[model samples]
Target: MTVKYLICGAGPTGLGAANRLMELGENSFLVLEREAYAGGLSASFTDANGFTWDVGGHVLFSHYPYFDALLADLLGDDVLTHQRVSRVRIAGGWVPYPFQNNIRHLPPEERWECVRELLPGRRPEITPANFREWFEVVFGKGIARLFMAPYNFKVWATPPELMDFRWIGERVSVVGLEQVLKNIILARDDVAWGPNNTFHFPLHGGTGEIFRRLAARLGDRVRYGDGLARLDAEKRRATTQSGEVIEYETLLSTMPLDLMVTDVLSEAPNAVREAAKSLAHNSVHVCGVGVAGLRPDPTCWMYFPEADCPFYRVTNFHNYSPNNVARPGEQMGFMAEVSSSPHKPVDKAAVMKHTVQGLVNTTLMRPGEAEKAVTAWQMDVEHGYPVPTLGRDAALAVIQPWLASHAVFSRGRFGGWKYEVGNMDHSVMQGVEWAERMLLGKPETTYGA
Candidate 1:
């Protein structure tokens, strides 16, 4: 008998698994996507003027050999690889990124203050019990106090002390203590580390094109706009919003963890459910402001760790591809990524108004040039980055195993709730690995390995 499989959530992970199964002559699989599109949060939208913005700022950076192989297989030479050039905007200065490694760029008196704080004699011995502690240990009080602390607070929307650091690894590059001291004295800039040191982007399409290509390859096996409303784990079945019942021998879910635990399981394990409750997340509002003129800066993306700008980062979308927006000489656009919270009502109009104002404030757009060159503006909000808090590990420990026992594989940015493995490459490989585990009985490498 052929093994029957049901893959929920047609995001990258689900598609990865489905694609893998197909590759291995094991094609007994069905893909269900809630959204009308296939990319999940990685999806992009095009406005009336043809300005395209991803759900949030997304870059194609892969860590696995399989990822490179798969992407090469899919897009082939259509992919354009670019070197990562990044910097942190702090205290009205464009500090070289990996801020801890470039402390020498600071002014003399301020540099003295930072160095004085890091003095071996002056450094205090404190057991770093949280993320903040771990960060300070590597960066010291000077760098952490100046940028790490406040910037992290804004990004995570919680104190770093409330977060666990086990997921740090290669996700966040740490400056060598010796190099920090050497750079401080010599004033050198180090830009070698970080995951995206050398990354690739699609030449003619957005990141979603990767998914669309996958879905296209799947053909009729992939279904879209069919959201999962509820599930009966005991019956190994799920009900879509369209009231269609999908039964399967095994279920691979790439949906949010909270939805699975609370809505699917009978009585949903309280400990597991509550741990998910403790997990916090931030929403991303991606604004695509188009101008009918030449492109802006040549940079791929710029970081804003400062409070002067509302956006944490800005990607020159037009830079990614001239085709990402209107025709050449017809005008191009830029994407501003502003994070928001459900706790506070996001003023959509204000977001646009201030976003344009912010462009001028940051010299992203020259005075009066914006009005003349600007043709139209668009905004899209996606439940973006997952907040890694202290409670995550404990909650995941309870929730993950419970789903696994039921043969339900939960994976993806929101599904797995792991910030470290939340990127496009990671999430896609997760789905691929999930299929290998189920079909080929391979070991899981995403969360466990």
Candidate 2:
């Protein structure tokens, strides 16, 4: 088959591009999805016991108006608005989210330690180069040692010394000593810290319902269960796993940039392949445990930085929407995310066992609640977070030019290899912007800029 635009993967990016291309009156585009279903990582699944689980903790918030309008149109009355209630487990107690901004909640000794170091010239005098140094400089050693260093290691599974700090953007809650002290002295709780302080979620069907409805609108333009296996970039031809070959003028790939360069494309230049090798990423293991009876905590999610918990963060999945549970308010679901890389290897076989026990250790569940677990669901994603290693930007510079030269544009979380703009909103707009760049000669803004 021949087409004007060929999109690989039916994830948010691919769907966004195809939707925009069609809205722009271009019907010559086709989307290929490897899975029989859509939504990629955003997809939700129902276990044998009927509890719905997402690949990981995903909350809906937007940085783009186009995305906001699109979501409103797609979900309408099916969506539920939420005020984020998140907390962190530290120093053997619960501190509000944005741990630095609310250190007053900490025990007297630790709170004084955090305030004392930030009082004067206790921080390093040298300019910061990496994430570890950046946080230590901005937040002094006490806060960095307590929260930043350990929590980041758990989440990224890469040493902060190896990561660049530019990706911090708004993803991190940056606070100064003055404001930190003010909050502490005033007994204020700084809970609303990030863009997701106010967010939305589908009323039912977990976070994937938005995409499920979106795929319905695109109709047969999307061909599911078939995705690119190999690409002959020079010939503008792609071979699918089903043995069908497609010829296209423009290719937009949502696959991981590394795999796109080394595995599927197959004939990339040695420099590009070597560059792909330098790119780093971590895997995520999400374990959901559904227990009988209601959970008293109203927290949407909680972070774990100490060794007591195997997971970095856990979500009150049932709070996002009661429909997430089989019996709504009668049952509760805890979805926890554990990240892994070569630097931090996880025993996958023991993930669920560890996750449940961790839930008890962290006080998210009572010891007796483990026995009350009606269902436990787990999903492991090989490429979870795109690590912003020190060499990431330089590696992307090498790989992107090669792809551009071959008329293959890769843009998404993994496609762009940029964590700064890898949220659900950013991932979708990366696709839309790519479409605008192709059809209207507009420079891409989300990923390109």
Identify the leading candidate in terms of TM-score. 2
> Where is model 2 more than 4 Å wrong at Cα?
none
Residues 2-31, model 1: lDDT tens digits: 138888888888888899989888878888
Per-residue lDDT for 1-449 in model 2, tens only? 99999999888999999999988999998899999988988889889898999889999999899999999999899888999999999988999999999999999999998988787798777799999999999999999989999999999999999999998889888888899989987999999889999989999898788788888889998999988999999999999989999999999999999898888995988999999999999999999999999957789999999999889999999999999999988999999999999999999999999999999998888879898899999899999999999999999999998888889998999989998998999988999999999999999988964
Specify the poorest-scoring 10-residue window by lDDT in model 2.
117-126
Clashes of 2: 0
Off by over 4 Å in 1: 1-3, 184-187, 264-266, 329-332, 342-346, 373-382
Model 1 misses residue 425 by how many Å?
Answer: 1.5
RMSD of 2: 0.9
Query: Against the correct fold, how does model 2 do in TM-score?
Result: 0.99
Clashes per candidate (backbone, < 3 Å): 0, 0
> Would you list the C-alpha lDDT of every candidate in the order shown?
0.76, 0.92
